[model samples]
Target: MVADAIYSCLPDPKEISPVETAPDPEDYQFLAVGFWVDKGTADQKAREYMTKIRNKKIGVFGTLGAYPDSDHANTVRERVRELLKENDIMDLFLCQGKVDPELVKMMAETMKDDPHHSMTPERRARLKEAEKHPDEDDLKNAQKVFEQIMVSLNN
Candidate 1:
């Protein structure tokens, strides 16, 4: 959804490609990579792609299970920044996304024995809150952010 929102605002002559099937960076003047955060870090594929991209204007947008402005989200953002510190990151945007109930259930079962398990009441509540997100407002904000990114890329 975030990628769709960003694509909606991007100029023509643009192509969206998956990181697995990435095209040559030299073929495009600007690039935007979007991914879902997993285990508190940018997706591994995104990190790998970043390593191959250099000397291009780049923007990153992604979704997480945490609220967009939460401390956890901020830390994830900082981690992404560090990961791409060698590249020219034009902007970074993140928003909350629904957690998979199946994954949550599996995690809960796996952590049932651990005292410091992640399936705490607070975590479950946060996951519940995430179910409503990447909502209309989130998509709109993603579009706006990418629109500005496009403008910056043009300049």
Candidate 2:
């Protein structure tokens, strides 16, 4: 499994399974976590671990990514924002020792008001549908509208 391989590669590797829940941020300096491209067993397993971590009131969680520019990466980052807001937990998301600048900008832009975001008609329709739901899943559903526009104009 990807989680097993990552743990094997880590310096202080621990055999963490989804069944084992994590403690709160108050209990630890950081809640280290991982994800995989294959969302079958890997994704389900990771979510179990994250759910346990979230239940502990631990807001600080880290995610290591293979592709930083992938939509899944964007989804994870956006999901973290929704988690923080929902849990009433204030903490930083660190990829390593340093924070991700793109994520920071995304969070900031999300908090601010903007009118001229480049939303295509189809995307707008999806956003409208997401607005109807207004849940964590919906947040994930509609992030492309924000994520695409939030990227550098140079691209």
Per-model C-alpha lDDT, please?
Answer: 0.85, 0.39
- Give candidate 1 misplaced runs (Cα > 4 Å): 113-116
Positional deviation of residue 41's Cα in model 1 after best superposition, in angstroms? 0.9
What TM-score does structure 2 among the candidates reach? 0.30
lDDT string, candidate 2, 20-93, tens digits: 45444355433335443232113455555555453333223333322334465566666655544434343323
Query: What are the RMSD figures for all models against the true structure?
Result: 1.7, 16.3
lDDT of 1 by residue, 4-84 (tens): 778878989889878899887778888888878988988899888877777777888999998888988999999988887
lDDT of 2 at 70: 47
Model 1 per-residue lDDT at 132: 91
